[model samples]
Target: MLAHIHIRNFAIIDEVELELEGGLTVLTGETGAGKSILVDALGLALGDRADAAAVRHGQKRAEIALTVDVGALPAVRDWLAEQMIDEGDECLIRRVIGAEGRSRAFINGQPVPLASLRTLGEQLVDIHGQHAHQSLLRGDEQRRLLDHHGGLEALATDTAQAWQQWQADRRTLEEALGSREERDARLELLRYQVEELEALALAEGELETLETEHRRLAHAEKLAAGVQAALAALYEEEFAAQPVVARQLRQLETLAELDPALASVRDLLKDAEIQLGEAADGLRRYADDADIDPQRVQWADRRLGRIRELARKHRVEEQALHAVLPELTAELEALEALDAKLEHLEQAVERSEQAWRALAEQLSQGRQQAAKSLGGEVTALMQALGMAGGRFEVAINALAPGKARASGLDGVEFLVSANPGQPPRALSRVASGGELSRIALAIQVIAADAGSTPCMVFDEVDAGIGGGVAEIVGRKLRELGERCQVLCVTHVPQVASQGHRHLHVSKSGGRQTRTKIQRLDDTGRVEELARMLGGVEITARTRAHAEEMLGQAAQSAALRRT
Candidate 1:
């Protein structure tokens, strides 16, 4: 419920603070009395688009704030938790619009994006205006309104979930079907590529091994020739150097027998002969083992070249060729299985469509029943609001062949005939602005028990209504207030008299005026009602009449309570 509203430098309202209470509150004023300005300020505080022209003269900015009590509203509590805003018992929405058209919004004293403020405001209050009458003409809105009235939110949610699942399944199936042709071509290409790669029979590290062997074999002839030359120099019969060393060692041994110092030279010569003999033996072994075959070298080179060529063809390094082979094989296998997968997807789609149709049919039946009940309730409400001959109907038609949606398979449109002998037409097309407001009121009153919003605002709902009709409108508004907080702007004394609270708006100076809202006592209310009844003059008869109207309104309210 809206607890308070404060406005500063907004249009003709220079500064005003209004403490509001639950139940019907009416703002009454003469023409050009800034009544609309109050509503405009509230609209801005509720996240409506800001206009620089709304700023009062001599002010740089216009500010509006609304305090809403939401302690008992679970939806609001949950929403606030979700938004991560901190507030106790009440939520305050504030908007400041600069003279340059720049605007900012805040929730509970914490700055917030305008969009967030808008979302929260919608959850808190619903503003009904004459222009909103067009909503009755829309099939979608009608369906939603009816659904809300029927308290079938859970069923609608189930239907929506089922529909989303069905759509997802269908999308999966379509994607599978659409890829068949592409998959077939891909399968063929993968098969050829896999076969080509398999035929190469590439092995890890095989290229490196082949290159090493090729280098060794290419140098084999030169290595063998150098070993042979070293063997001849060390061990060949006539050209042997080791035999000469042996003969010199014998002569040194004979000389050592004559001189002790010469024995050291003989021992050194003996060691040199032993080392030379070992070196010659090593050269012989190396010569015997060296590779000299050109065919082996050519074979190693060809193997390395084949590996390089395969790597180049696959656009990978020679060592990475082996890794590519496995991935290519997997791709081929996947492509080969496309047809089977596609068949499964098609079956899934069929089952999903069937499930969707079943759920949609059930939902359609529920909506049909709900629409009937809703139409009856609204029709009764219309009769009470001075549309005695008005006929209200809910027309439901299928939007799709079999599939359902979040709302239902059927489209709902509200039809009305405001006069006797008149054919029912779309409510938007048949009703005048005043009739539309009353119709909206009726619908809202019927839907109040099912909706979550705690407050409803009607702008000039009493337009084009007076006398007994105005009294009826007032009674209905007061009845609606019993269910939810209602704020109505009206010029009718009867309507104004029905409110639990009354606010008066008037322009004082050329550009300096203010709006004042006060919770009226019984006497003050009567006085205000008298003023509403007799223009600017409050005669004794008018005051008496106003008191009588208040007494009747009280009696009606008491009966409604019973």
Candidate 2:
């Protein structure tokens, strides 16, 4: 329920604050009394598009605020909680439009994007009029209304979940199917590469060890020749250096015995002779061990060249060849198993399609049942709204079989005939502006119990209705208010008299023309009703007639309460 509305510098409304109450509230005034301006302000507060021209002449911006009671709407409370906005029993939506066509929106005084505000507004109130009626002309809206009225939300949710699962399965099948030809081509290449890698039989660290052995063997002849020359110099029989060093050491020992002062020199010569003999023996042993084999060296060099060639051909380091082999082997194995996997995927796709069709059939049945019940209820409401000869029908058609789509496979259309003996035509083609409004009202009334919005606003629902029919319309609006708050903009005296609260919209000229709204008391309401009855000429008879209408409305309201 809308608790209050405040408008400032918006069109003809310079500043107006309307405090609202529950049940039906009616706003009434004469022609050019700026009643429409009040509705426009409410629309802006509900996140309607803003225009720079709406700002007052001297003002930099226009502002509209609507405070709505949302305690009963769990969807709205959850949405606010998700946005991290405060969740109170009441929610305030405010819009400020600058002169430059820029606008800002606030929810509960916290700034938010206009889109968020629009989403929340949609969950709070629904404003119905000619424009709203035009929207109802669509087939989808009719289907949605039917679903809402028939209490089929849970079924629809189940269908949606099933459809989503079906789509996911189908997508997986498509991806697997699309790659079949490419995978076959890749399989042929993988098989050949794997066979080639297997034939090489490369071993880890084999390349490094082979290269080291080849380098050592290649220099063996030069190394052995150098060792033999050193051995000859150290151990030749006639010119043996070890014998000469031994003779010098013996002469130094004899001199040391002759004179003690020569003893230190003799000891040093003895050490030199011992070192020389050890060196000669070591050289002889190295010469004997250094044996060169040309054939073995050549074989090792050729093997190393072959390994390097294989490494280059495979585009890898010699040591990395071992790692590449396993990857190639796995690719070949995957290729071998591809056909079996594809067959399995094909079967899965068929299963998915069958599951989807079964669920779709169930959903279609539910919709058919709901459509019949909804059409009957709406038709009954239309008759009560003075369309006694009208016929209402729902037409459901099936779409082509394929991946599951949103709203299932059925395309629904609403058909109606405004008069007896006329063929029912599509609602969009047969319904006039005023007729559409009434039909929308009927649908809304039927679905009121299912709708979550706590407030409903009707802008001139009595546009083409008058007399007893207008009274019936007022009765219906009052009945609707029993379930949710209803704000109606009407000129009919009977409708105005039925309101639990009455607001009078009037314009006054100051520096600029401005609209104002005031909640009228019982006496004030009578004067306003009289004005609506007699226009500018409010006589005693008109006042008395207004009093009679009020009395009747009060009695009707009391009966409804009972």
Candidate 3:
């Protein structure tokens, strides 16, 4: 149940704080007093779409906050826990809408997506707008209400899922069968491509190896010549540097006996001579081992040419050629098994259709049973609301199985007859605005007990009918409050008189007007009710009548409790 709400800079409200209770609370005010604005603010907190105009003129933003007591709702508690924002049994929801048309939502002070707030809000509050009857003319809405009334939402969801699965499988089968020629052509191409790539048998790093070997073989003669020339310069020729360094070392060693400084030069000459000998030996081995083979060079060049050709044919780099084979092979395998796959998909479509039919049939049966019960109840309520001998019916028409939709194979329409001895016809054609309002109220009152939401808000649901009908509507709402909190915005004096709590909304100020809501005490309630009943002027007689109404309503409430 909603325990508290704080609103700031919203519409005509500059700032307001309201401490709420769990019962039927009524808000009464003159037209344009912003009675519905409070309901709109609560709707915004519950994740309704926000508008920049909702922010008070010249204000930067509008803010709405609500504190909900979830002690009795284990599902809500579990949802809070799952979101990792649980704080005992109370949940705080806040909404801020900037003047620039941007909005943000928070749960327990932690920023959350608007969708998260909506999900949690559905579990906490069920708001019935004044215009609900207008939408009730829709077939889909009728079906949804029926399912909700019958507690068949889960079964309907299962049926929808099965229908979706059947459609998906059927689409796949149709696509495959329709594109058989294209599939066959693609299959042939993939098979050939896979074969060619497999035959090449390229390995990782093999491209770099082949290129290296090709360069080496192609330049074998030039490399050999360079080695021979270096060998001659270092040691191979007569009177080469090796023998010269040896003679220099012998003279330096002899002088070193006389002067120790010459010993350093002698050691340098000896090291130079040793390096020259090692160079000559290395050059001799290379001349012996050099492969200057024309046959191998030709073979390396042909292998490289073939790799480049295949790379260009496949529209890939030579280095990437190794990846092409596996991809083509996988596609080829899939196409090769097309017949088997089509058979499997056909069976899947058949099975899915069967599952969908079973669930839809079960749902149809439930709706039929629920329809009978609901029609009878709403018809009875219509009579109580002053539509004597009125008739209400739920007409279910079956749809073709081959063209089944996600909702089901049934189309539901609400039929109504608003006068005695009149044949029931489509509600949209037969009911007036006032009659629709009464009918909508009837459905809501009946379905209220079927829902588990802790709070229900009605925005002038009693908009049309009046007199005794208004009093009955008020009593029904008060009865509903026994199970959960209900907040109603109404102008009906009878309805306002029946609430467990009454709030009077009035506008003050001129250009910068602000809406103020005050909870009415006994005398205040009498005055407000007198104003509603007597309109522009409140006389002593009107005041007396308002007091008597309150007295009788209180007595009736006490009797019901007993």
Candidate 4:
């Protein structure tokens, strides 16, 4: 339920705060007193499209804040929790529109997209605009009302899900059973590619090892020649350096016997000779083992060329080709099993179609049953609303068998006969403006029984209705209020008198011309009602009449409870 609204700098409304109630509440004002501004402010807080022109002249921005109780609304509570904006028992929505046409919205102090606000707003309230009742004329809204009233919403949802799954299965089957030419071409290419990759049979790191060996073999001749030259210069030649170092070491040893210092010198020379001999032996071994095999180099080149050629064919690097091979093999395997996959998809489609048909049939039956009961209820309500003898009907016709749709396979429209002996016709064709308002009100009263909204805003629902008919509409609205909180903007004295609480909007202040609202006391309400009854003046007779209407309304309300 709407707990409060605070609006500032909106149109001519400089600042106005209101505390709303649960039962029937009415807003009545003069023609230019800015009642519509308040309704527009409420709409803004509920995520309606913003307009910069609605901002007060010379003001920088307009702001609206709405507070609502969500303790009894589990869906709204859950949504707030999902958005991480759940307060203990209340949800506060704030909307701000800048003079430059920019706007921002928030829920419970957390910034949110307008769409989130819209989604949550729908659960909390249903605001019907001027002529919004005309939406009843649309077939889609009619079907939704029927389904909701019939308690077939769940089955309708199931049908949509099943139909989607069935369509997905059909698409899968079509792809699997591709054109014959395309399938044959792909199969041949995959088979050959798989065979070629398997034949290569390369190891993980074999390429790097092979490349090193090839480089070594290709330079073997130069390496062998350098090795033999080093050996000859060291020890393999006729007067090798090792023999000279040996003779010097022997002389030093003989001299060392003569003197102690000479002995240290002889040991150093002997260690050098030993190092030289080891170096000579290592060079000789290398010369004997050096190889210059051209044939092996040619073999290495051929192996590398084959690997590169395969890499180019597959559009991958030589190293990455190994990874690609396994993936291709998997694809080829799937192609080979195409027949089995096709069979499975076809069977899945059939199963989903069967499930969808069963749910659709159930939904259709429920709608048919609900249509009859709803038609009867609405027709009776019309008679009570001053359209005596007017009849309402719900016309349900089946769609063609092959036309698959998310909203079951039936077309629903509202039909009516406004007078005695008149043939029933479509609602739009048979009802005039005033009759349409009554008809729409009658349907809404019945639909309200199944509605989940906690608050209902009927903006000018009494339009094109007056006299006793207007009072009856007020009573019907009050009856709806018993189920949910109601907010009505009315110009009818009869409706205004019926409100459990009333607010009078008046424009004052000369230069600024600001709009203000006040909760009416008993005397204040009488004066306002008298103003509505008479034109610009309130006489004694109008005052008496207004007082009598209030007494009658109060008595009527008291009797309704019992």
Candidate 5:
């Protein structure tokens, strides 16, 4: 239940606080007295779009806050928890619009996105605007209204989910089938590419090894000449340096026998001869091992050129050329299995489509059953709301199976005839705005009786209705209040008198006028009603008449319980 509402700096409303109660509460005032401003203000708290013009002339911003008693509302509590807001028995929703058109929303004093506030607001209240009947003309809304009334929302949801699943599966199947030719062409290309990659078959590190070998073989001639020169100097040449040094050593040995100074050099000459012998052996071995094979060098160069050519053909770096082989092999495998994969996807699509149709069939039957009962209830309600001999029907027609729609297989419409002998037609075409408003009221009352929303607000639902019908409308509204708290904005004294509580909206102060809303006591209600009864003047007769109407309204309310 909406427990309270506070408005500050809103258009023509400087500050107004309302302590709301559960019952039929009516707001009555003269024309242009801001009777509907309360409704507009409540809309803001419920996350309605705000504008700078909504703020008062000199105020920085306009603020609207609503306090709802949510002790019995677990959805609201859960939502608060999900939004990370402060939790309690009551939830406060506030919205503020700056003078620059910027806006903000808060729940339990925690700022939140406008969307979060909107989602929670939808659960808390259902406001039936004066033009609600216009929506009744729409088949989609008609179907939704019927579903809600019949408690088939779960079935509707199941149908929708099934349809979406079928759509997704169908998309996959279409893609697989649509690209069959392309896949075949790709299969041929991948096979050829894979075979080429496999034929190259380059081993890891082979390229580096081949390059190193190629460099050494290409320079083998130069390497061999250097080794031969060293060997000749050490041992090969008859006039070689090592031979000459050996001859000198022999001469020194003879001299050393003659001279003692020369004898000391003999040990050094022997050491030099030993070192030269080792050097000559090492050089001779290297010269023998050197590879100057031009044929082998040509083979290495050809192999490296083939690898580079393959790398270029595949658009891969030489080092990464080996990595491409596996990817091509995988693609070839998938192409080989393409036919089987497509067959499997086709079966899945068929299964999902069948599932959606099965659920749609159930929903269609449920709607057919619900339509009958709802139509009867609404038709009965119309008679009580001043449409005597009226007929209301819920028309359900099947659409082609190939036609895809989220709302199941049947198209639902609300048809109405306002008088006897009149053929039933679409509600929008058959009913005036006044008739539409009353029909909307009847539907809401029926929905409320079936245990839907706990709070309903009707702004000027009594438009174009008066006389005994106005009394009936008031009585029905009061009765609806018994099931769900109802807030009505009206100028009808009959409706105003029937409310358990009443509010009077009027301009206060001079020059700079501001809207003032005050909850009326018994005397105040009577006075307000009298003012509604007699314009500009509250005569004694009007007061007496207002009191009489209130008495009769109370009596009528009692009889309804009986």
Candidate 6:
């Protein structure tokens, strides 16, 4: 239920904060007094498109915020939780529209996209615009209303998803079937590529190893000469380091016997001689073990050439050639299994089609059932709204199989018979403006009652009707409020008097005209009602009439509660 609304610098509204309660609440004022502006501002908070012109003149921006109780609304709570912005039991939605037409929206203090605000808003409030009846003439709107009233929205959504999936799969299968020659060509190419890669049989890291070996063999002679020179300098020559170090070590040893300090130097000379000898031995072994055969050099060159040639052929680096094999092989395997895949996709398409058909059928049945009930209910409401013999019917026509749509296979239209003995005809064809308004009101009331949205806003729902009919319309709304929160923008005194709470919107100031709204007390309601009944004058008779109307409305409400 909507708990509060705070609007500032919105249109003629300078600043107005209202703490709203459950049940019927009405806003009434003179023409251009900005009663409907409040509803529009509420719409802004509920994610309606913003307009720069909606900002008050000379103001930088317009702001509107709404607080609603979500304790009983699991769907709304679930949405908040999914968005990770849940505030226990209450939801706050705010919108700001800059004078430059830029807009920002927020939910639970977290900035959100307009679409997210809209998505969550729908579950919390359902606004019935003053001109809603205009859109009701469209076929799509009629279908949507039927679906919404029937509680088949989820089923319809599932049907649409299934149909889309089936269509997508069909397209895929058709594309595949159309390209058989291309598939055959691709298969041939892939098979040859896979065979070529398999023949190479390259192993991971093997290329690097082969290249190192090839470099070693290609420069073997230079390496062997370098190693022999090193050995001669270290040990092979008679004046090599090993012989020099041995002569030095014996001299140091003789001196160390006379002086202990020279003993350490003698040990160092001996260690150096031993190390030099080991180095010469290592170099000699390397020279002996080195492979310097020309045949091996040619073999290494050929092996590297093959690997590089294949790498260039595949447009890959020699180091990456090994990775391409598995990729090509996998594609070849899949292409070889094309027939199996085709069969599987075909089966998938069939299953999706069946699923869509089943869901559509269920939706159709549900609509049929709901249509009968809704038509009967609306026809009854029309009777109370001064349409004595008017009849309402939901016409369900099946579409041809070739002309299927995602919503369902059935086309929905609202048919009306305004007089007894007249055949029911399309609303647009037979219903007059007044009749349309009444029918629209009846349908809206029924739909709103059936829906789960916690709050309903009806702007001028009693338009085109007056006298006892207006009072009846007001009664219907008040009765609806008994179940949920209701906010109505009304001009008729009969309707205004029926509200459990009344707010009077009045404009003041000359060039800086601002709209102010205040809740009405009993005396205030009577005076306001009298003003509505009387034009620009308040008389004793109008006051008495207004008092009577309020008295009757109060009695009716009391009886309803009982």
Q: After superposition, how far is residue 402 of candidate 4 from its true place, in Å?
A: 3.3
**Weakest 10 consecutive residues of candidate 6 by summed lDDT:** 193-202
**Model 3: lowest-lDDT 10 consecutive positions:** 444-453
User: What's the lDDT for all of these models?
Assistant: 0.81, 0.80, 0.90, 0.85, 0.85, 0.91
- Looking at model 5, which ten-residue stretch has the lowest summed lDDT? 444-453
Expressed as tens digits, the lDDT of each residue in 1-562 for candidate 3 is 9999999999999998899999899999999999889989999999999999999999999999999999899989999999999999889999999999999999999999999999999889988888889888999988888887788888999999999999999999998899899998898888788877777788889999999988888888888899988887777678777877887888889999999998888888888888888888998998898878888889888878888998999899999988888888887888888879989989999999899989999999999988998899899999999999999999988987566688888999999999988999999999998899999899888777566778999999899878999999888898888789999999899888898999899999887999998999999999999999999999999999999889978888899999
Local error of candidate 4 at residue 220 (angstroms): 31
In model 4, which range of ten residues has the least summed lDDT?
285-294
Candidate 2 residue-wise lDDT, 1-562, digit = tens: 7888888888877788888888899999877878877777787888889899989888999999888887877777888899988658888888999999999999988999888888888777877763556777877777677677666665666777777776777788788768878888888877776676677666788778878877778887776777676666656666766677678778878888998898898788788777777776776777676666788888787777766776787799878877877887887787677678777877877776677667767778877987787788778878988898898888777877663475777888888898889998999899887787778767766676556667878887567667886787788788778778888888888788888889998888777787778889889998999998888889999999999999998899899889
Show where candidate 1 strays beyond 4 Å.
Answer: 74-93, 100-108, 112-116, 152-209, 215-237, 241-245, 248-272, 283-301, 314-366, 385-389, 401-410, 417-425, 428-438, 518-548, 558-562
Native-to-model Cα distance after best TM-score fit, residue 423 in candidate 2, in Å: 5.2
Candidate 6: what lDDT? 0.91
Per-prediction CA RMSD (Å): 5.5, 5.8, 9.5, 7.9, 5.5, 10.1
Best by lDDT: 6
Q: Using alpha carbons, what is the TM-score of model 1? A: 0.75
Candidate 4 local lDDT, 1-562, one digit each (tens): 9999999999999999999989888999988899877887888888899999978999999999999988988888888888888997888999999999899999999899999888888778777666766898899988888886786776888988988887888788777766746877888998898888788877788888888888878888777788778767767677777777788888988888877789888888788888887887787777677666778889889888988999999998988777867888899888778757777888998998888888888888999999998899989988888888889899889998788587877888989999987988998898888898888877776776667789988778678888998898888778778788988899999888888899999999788998989999999999999999997888999999999999999999999999
Each model's total of backbone clashes: 0, 0, 0, 0, 0, 0
User: In candidate 6, what are the lDDT values of residues 292-383, reduced to their tens digit?
Assistant: 88998998898889888989988998899999999988888888798798998899899988999999999999999999989999999989
lDDT of 6 at 162: 93
Compute the lDDT of residue 549 as modeled in candidate 1: 97
TM-score of every model?
0.75, 0.74, 0.74, 0.73, 0.77, 0.75
Give candidate 3's TM-score: 0.74
Q: lDDT per residue, candidate 5, 59-108, as tens digits?
A: 89999999999888887788788778847898988999999999999999
Decide which is better by lDDT, 1 or 6.
6
Model 5, 142: alpha-carbon shift in Å?
2.1
As for candidate 1, its clashing pairs are none
